[model samples]
Target: MTATDLPAKPYRNTAFDASINNPSAYASTLDDSFAAIDWQASWLCHLNQLGYISKSISQLRGLKNDPAQTEKLEHTPDIIAKVLNTALQKHADALQQSLPQTKPALNNQAQTLKFVSQNELPEGEAYERFIGTTGNIPTRDNLHDLFNGSIWLTFPKTKALLNYYHMLEIKEQGIGASRGRVRDTITVFDENGAILVTAESSIGKALVDFDWQESLVAPRDKWDEPKQLNKQAQAAVYIFGHALLEKLLHPRKALCAHSIVINVTQDFFTLSLSERINHLDQKVADYMDALLSEPDVSPRKLSPLPILGVPHYWAENVQPSFYEDSQVFRSGRRSQS
Candidate 1:
């Protein structure tokens, strides 16, 4: 490869407390676990470079200034809300929304935050009803909730739209044992949704048609910053799932995302980071808007994307042989004549 073929940036992670990946802050340690994360494993250090990833790290202050303060820096709901709110306010008005303050773990309830009495909002009102009507997200202090809150900050519009649809379902079905197809689709996407933006609609079609090699392999170089996955390039993945983000913290080859495909113009690759994020935010929200417009929606609208196999996101994929793992990169849902 010529000099021009080389990527402009190198892998380096100067910020973010790696220990924040730990599920609990209560763990005692001085063993350099804080810096042990494989920050540079993703090409161009993409994982380390995500702006919201660091923002979700609430313990950065205590850990950076003094490792001893790990115990002192508890991620209470109020703190997590403030952190999310501060991060959200940094964006445009569309991204701006008030985070509900964290309520203490009342009546010996473990791992709870920003909660209300079970008697507070009728019997069946949970995730959607509480958020939609009471305007309060019933949460408790915990790692999982933190990741969910992080996603809300990242994709406020999409999250709100998901809640809106869930409320519609609840109104129709009344939170029965069976959530019906539409609710199931909303839940699946809410918990593990991602948006894959490609300049070419054919590329998106390849993924939807389960043309794994065509979408993931042959077009590998065409992905965002093939030379260095962080820079401006063709396509990008915007992860909107909080659970998926949590799983990615300790990235494994098996991890995947239920991805929504949004094809954009060829010039998309040239936009700034903020511009891309805002554009994807609006784009995905618009897609979700149209999706929920129909009463009968299906999770099939989302395509399966083995997130690790995304171009340079995982180092193992640098060698084409990595895609040979059929368990991870399956052949397809293609037809039989």
Candidate 2:
């Protein structure tokens, strides 16, 4: 046989494809439990060299707005107001185009960043009820950490828009957490970029639900019956959330789990999965232990499934669990006016 016609070499390794197949592998170190520390560091350095960190902040800044550091508070406030106003206007237009089912009236109030809605608001009153005072405006510090910058609006599919709005609510009012959307969305793309998978936010929220409970790795019993799955992740999986559809996009910056509660036992190490868990578990455990041992402090939750994953085998049994009266957006429904 000609050399050019020869079959490609077979790829073999002890590494499990589940973790590496995830997009989060390119963004964070949480999956390094089995990985050598040097290897993790080197890989992270390479990812950074590819401009992941800088690009993320740059995109986020564009989504929000950074008033260039100015010496005067007077000039800064006006600049900050203009920047935020611009973001609101752009988001408003995107929202108008997202839902074609309902006819929305363009309230003159959007230019001023007030709450307005259409009948098909996928996220409900969460954004409108966000507690921050509109007149207070946002601080320079707040502008720099804009969330949901990397996500794009896809018409007729309102989840992305709602998720982005959720990010805005959290940023504007400090109402909820802000790390999962990017990590989970990016993870999907990194793992199955070749496939055409559409991600719905309810599914992302289901992942966040698992994250909040520290129960991402559901035991096997939960998946045997499809009927038991929750409204979010079940649909996410059904829609092929595992496929990596946008791999060519720039990698996201690493996410860190913030303050969290913990109950570490000397025996807990024995409870871990044999080969599938990320080596970064120890670091996570350490952070949790530190927070739990401290007095007079609240721990912030971190995004799960970034570096490693929810442990695919463990997820085999997980069913989505939706809460009644929750503000989560279910698949289907968007209003364009």
Candidate 3:
């Protein structure tokens, strides 16, 4: 059978489900066992090898003991640079050994970056054509880049495929401030979790059929509450950019960032991690092909893609009701002027 025909597989959601009836039963699975020193050493070594000493160091500090530091670092690029450089000095010996030489060659690549899956490198001509540009690749020095790079390492194929489609759409439609098909394919994380809804899917007739606005606007304060947790998990697909895995653990009728929220059983996460990646990579590939092959295809016609973002990332001018507005949740009742 085709990949599309294959059953949905379970994956871990980084957002803890405090509502789970028996937390102890799943507690062991969440443990990463590494101490702070070990975690720092490991990341420093990895980033150094990749020539991202400063970025890795900054991320470790910003994310020192918690993964949620990403939101704080997002707005403080200056602080990130300062802390990262300090980290490089503090861990000089480890960084020196990780590098190929005492000094590495540098280039004039652009500072404004876009992330692509490093795992898919040594790519063919077709891949290059799809990408349309070079040097936009993200570096490890930035928290955003580091988080994105982690996503690539974990979901290489899926990330690569999304990049492929993103570039293709950009080539066809050209870039603009307005949201497009390519932009929808990604999901960014915020303080609460992954943000699933985008500008396009947040309004019009679609809003009424599904509780998309309500699902999207719920705050972190209510996330742990059973009803709200289920609501957020149902509407969301937590692809933790800071971590190595993506979460689509719970099933819901709500729209996901990329496609439908398939029914993935807990047994799915039981498989080896590699097996899980293979399963998801194939599923995404199949979905992309099916999506593109349809007649009269457009971003609006396809499943609402997710581009997850952090809190301040979306907090600027969003309607307060989206998160605080109770009126947006009303169904089947049109206002009488």
Worst 10 residues of 2 by lDDT: 147-156
Which digits, one per residue and each the tens of the lDDT, describe model 3 over residues 1-337? Answer: 9863343232222222221222222212111222222322221222222334333343334343454443343222232233333333333334232201111012221121133343334544333232334422423333454444444433444455555555555557665676354444332211112212222322222333444444344442212121122222222233423432122222122213323333344444444433544455456545555565555454443333222211222332145433332342334333211
TM-score of each: 0.71, 0.22, 0.36
Model 2, residue 190: what's the lDDT?
23
The local distance difference test score of model 3 is: 0.34
Ranking by lDDT: 1, 3, 2
Model 3 residue 244 distance off true place after TM-score fit, in angstroms: 15
Better of 1 and 3 by TM-score: 1
Candidate whose TM-score is highest = 1
Clashes of each: 7, 19, 13
- Greater TM-score among 1 and 2 belongs to 1
Note the Cα lDDT for every prediction shown. Answer: 0.60, 0.25, 0.34
Higher lDDT: candidate 1 or 3? 1
